[model samples]
Target: MLLGSDVRRMLPPPAMGRFGDLLAATTSDTSGLADDMSGDRDANAKLIEAFRQGVEQPI
Candidate 1:
């Protein structure tokens, strides 16, 4: 019972509006190919590398 309540509380907030807005923004920027995580493996690799560098050397 305690574990069940903790699991439920760990879930993200029910913000449909905010999620929709974010989805719209991502799709708009990704050119409708946002669902293809493995379709553009090279692009994905570059993106991950860029993200890693950005995190390691912020600004």
Candidate 2:
């Protein structure tokens, strides 16, 4: 996600290492890092509420 903003949230952590050894062979950056991830509670809540509203729009 660019600048901690994404259309979707991150996937499950344990579900990432599908390739096992193959994945370990490569240097990856998407390690669910705290610094890269957003910790802004207010902004996150707003985004979540917006998503909920968008979903409810069709209903």
lDDT of 2 by residue, 1-59 (tens): 23122212242334433433333332233332323438875565555445434422322
TM-score of each: 0.34, 0.34
Best by lDDT: 1
- Inter-residue clash pairs, candidate 2: none
Reference-based lDDT, residue 47, model 2: 50
| Cα shift from native, residue 48, model 2 (Å) | 0.1
Residue by residue across 1-59, what tens digits does model 1's lDDT show?
34323433444556534543454455454544434676676676556444333333312
Report the Cα lDDT for candidate 2.
Answer: 0.37
Per-residue error at 32 for model 1, in Å?
23
Single out the weakest 10-residue window by summed lDDT for candidate 1: 50-59
